[model samples]
Target: MRASEDAGLRDRRRELLTGARGRVLEIGAGTGLNLPLYPEQGIVELVFTEPEEPMARRLDERAHARSPVPRVVRAPAEDLPFDDDSFDTVVSTLVLCTVGDQDAALREARRVLKDDGRLLFLEHVRADDAAGARRQDRWHRPWRAIGHGCNCNRATVPAIEKAGFRLEHVERGTVPKAPKIVRPLAVGVAVPA
Candidate 1:
């Protein structure tokens, strides 16, 4: 990734996570990159849900190394092991693109979130432009094969809406200098209905 692209992702991630507070659950907590971006003052606790064993181990290590250790759970997004409305906030960064069943995962997210709880996400999604979308469709097959099940052309916004959450805010833009086929990043907050 280019420096600009990395910075863009970091900025978008931070923006989505800035005010995250109360009991928080992060799905697909890969390597715990969002651990540091979490706000120190408002956040009451951090819980991470990761299914991959290797990535879970890394997330555990990272959490232990951080100032505030986060609770880590070994689980998939669609099958989260949490009580109903357990978290005040649910977060997913660069995650929905890879879930085997994105709709199920989003529904689970809403299921675990409080009625007024917020869902914050920073995701690389399918492009809105016709030409760019065409390219994304063309590259998705090979991309999924090599990128570990990640889809390059998911309509994340509509999917989130279909999962029963109301979109409150959304910001769509490119990850600077990244490949056009997978460049549209959606950063936003949604509320459970």
Candidate 2:
């Protein structure tokens, strides 16, 4: 799934990770797709996490393959093992919509983030157009059942704001060649409020 992303989308991912510094934690690190993009200097540590066992093993293998190998943890976003204000940066890409408790996970992300930390995200969101959003609402339940708990209609930007983070910059766009109902995306960075 990661490999199939358009060149532009892959470039967007790199743009989001290239400037990161200090301790970084990547939630839902499936297959460690973003592992190779972390900047070489300044970053103290990079952590990758995934909930499922099989995905965790794959992430482990991928992590070891990177130049600055990341630490892998088998854990869910709603509950992280780290202490509060522990990390300088937190990253989530295409993972929020599927979390069992989206609010809990967002709150957890804020909790572990340092007071001056930033959260970088790239996620599919509920559409702003009424008809499009309605379609997302209608397909959500069944879509989640078959798509690994990924609902195509989450109001991700609002959820990020509601999580008590102030957006530094955010933009919405569609994934090229993907279904429209699942393509409305939000890419941004937010800092703890």
Candidate 3:
């Protein structure tokens, strides 16, 4: 993953976060990788939710050392603890694929966001072509074990739409330095419908 970041995922993260402002909530913020990439101005508050204790601890450590130190919450994406309409922006990068329930997590994100809030996401999804998808299916079991529960074949964009978000923009692409089976990517911004 770090190799992927060094290859191009870092730039993707920067792109996903551009223009983000006001109160922000980032679900599944693994190790605060996006912390330094956030714009230097306009963000009133930044909070991160990570379900894993080890990752949350690292995230908290990294957050405290940053300029706009963010608050770290130990909570699952499927069950965020924030109040409704509290955030201006909600972000999910490389996270939706691992959530136990993608639709539930997206619903939670939508619930916490303000009426005009935006969801910025970058996730590896099921491939568009049948051959590629078959490859994903064939490799998925071992990959899931190696990835610690990350699913390589989830239809995440549709799940987001099913959760009541209207996609405002989307760019189909590939994950840098990742295996082809898990490289199919979608980066997008969605607003509450």
Best by lDDT: 3
TM-score of each model, in listed order: 0.96, 0.95, 0.97
Please report how far candidate 2 places residue 126 from its true position, in Å: 0.5
lDDT of 3 by residue, 1-193 (tens): 9899999989998988995889999999989999999998889999999999999999999999987678999999999998999999999999999999998999999999999999999999999999999999998899899989999999999999999899999999999989898899999999999
| Model 1 quality (TM-score) | 0.96
Candidate 1: stretches off by over 4 Å: 1-5
For candidate 2, the per-residue lDDT at 147 reads: 82
The per-residue C-alpha lDDT of model 1 at residue 190 equals: 97
The TM-score leader among the candidates is 3
C-alpha displacement of 17 in model 3, angstroms?
0.4
* Cα-based RMSD of candidate 2: 1.3
Candidate 2: clashing pairs of residues = none
What CA root-mean-square deviation does each model show from the true structure?
A: 1.3, 1.3, 0.9
**Weakest lDDT window of 10 consecutive positions for candidate 3:** 64-73
Q: Report the poorest 10 consecutive residues by lDDT, candidate 2.
A: 1-10
Sort by lDDT, best first: 3, 1, 2
lDDT of model 1 at residue 113? 96
